[model samples]
Target: MDPWLSMYDFTYHLAQEIAEKIHERNRYLRNGENPVKINLSVRTLLKRLEESIGQLRDSLLRSVSTRQITQLEGDRRQTLIDELLTKERQLQMSFKGDGTEPDVIRSSLMSGGGAGPSPYNPWVLEEPEETRGLGIGDLKQQQQRMIREQDAGLDALSNIIARQKQMGYDIGNELDEHNEIIDDLTNLVENTDTKVRNQTRHVKLVDKKSGSCAMMVVIVLLLIAIVVVAVWPSN
Candidate 1:
């Protein structure tokens, strides 16, 4: 396979995975459930997806600028990138409804997270007995600070689910269009092949008939010579 095509396939698979994670995350958010696990997964996957895309883009740029890439290959890769980016943006906008995703992230971070609530897990914050005495106002202030800090890393995770939904739709649409074209070409090739086979058979049949006629004519000429000799004066 072409390097560009290989890169495209990897990027596309990552994008698809990210999109699915986002959808699952969205459902979690809507239900006011904890999206910490999903969010973390998405973050991990999203990082990989971004890296894959980055590599793919670099390859595409190099190949395309050198005119080594076909227009179709370029279009397929470029279209996927465009669709992924657009879907990301669309999710950011549409998923803005309840805005629960951010709140859940903030809560998870304050509670502590990562690998089942360890000291460094961003999703789980331990509220011990001593801290329980702190006034509500002070606690709010602290939580707000934590939210801000976590949001720094969480900036992209927010509304990611919405984007995945749109991304899936867009990607599917683009693929469908290309698939239809491919189907048409495949059908055309099949039809042409059938015609060629039929013509080949016809040519073979005609050759066989012509050979038989020639053999019959040869036999007839031999017989006529014999008959002429028999009917002519002995000489």
Candidate 2:
């Protein structure tokens, strides 16, 4: 299985677990549970989901360097990561009495909505029909949870963008390396061409000197022959 796809599949499983836990918690919260109790917060489940997402991101980054995955595949992996994030945010908004639509989590996870009263059913969740009265302390804790949710999501997004930038740098570095090799080859060719031209020029100069020496010897021999013939005829 593709690393990214496998990680994304696991995220859905985690999301299913969180949905069941939320249902169970809300079932209790409505029946005399303390309004101020945040000890049962699904915050832990959310962290697990985030870790799954982080692993997916890490997997994709590794594939880029080690497997040399294409840009298109990388982009699809990124889309899956973003989808998981969207699911997480929707899940966070899924408290009972929050007035959120039933499909908030279901539609994000699966196109087929959900099933039976079993909390184990994927995306099957239960929430209070109306907001429960909360003490000031509970309200504060809820506020803090929301803030933390936003920060965690942002941090995840920041890490993803940073990894993408790093990938870009890796591509650029490879291009620089190729360009350097090309440049070295070009210089080698030019240097070889210059040496060949110099050798040709030296050969031509040697030929010119040899021709001059031969012409001088022939001229001297002709002059000596003319003097001998003239002197014998005079004698």
TM-score of each: 0.36, 0.39
How do the residues 1-235 of candidate 1 rate in per-residue lDDT, one tens digit apiece?
A: 9776777677666655655566567556544577888778777876676677677777778877888878887888787676555444333332343433443533333333233523443222233554343554666677788899999758667668679989999999999999999999999999999999999999999999999999999999999999998999975
Compared with the true structure, what per-residue lDDT tens digits does model 2 show for residues 104-201? 44444453322432334356553443434554466568768989999999999999999999999999999999999999999999999999999999
Q: Could you tell me the lDDT of residue 134 within candidate 2?
A: 52
What TM-score should be assigned to candidate 1?
0.36
* Reference-based lDDT, each prediction: 0.65, 0.70
In Å, residue 168's CA in model 1 sits off its true spot by 56
Q: Which ranges in model 1 have alpha carbons more than 4 Å from their true place? A: 71-76, 91-235
C-alpha-based local distance difference test score of model 1: 0.65
Worst 10 residues of 2 by lDDT: 112-121
What is candidate 1's CA lDDT for residue 229?
88
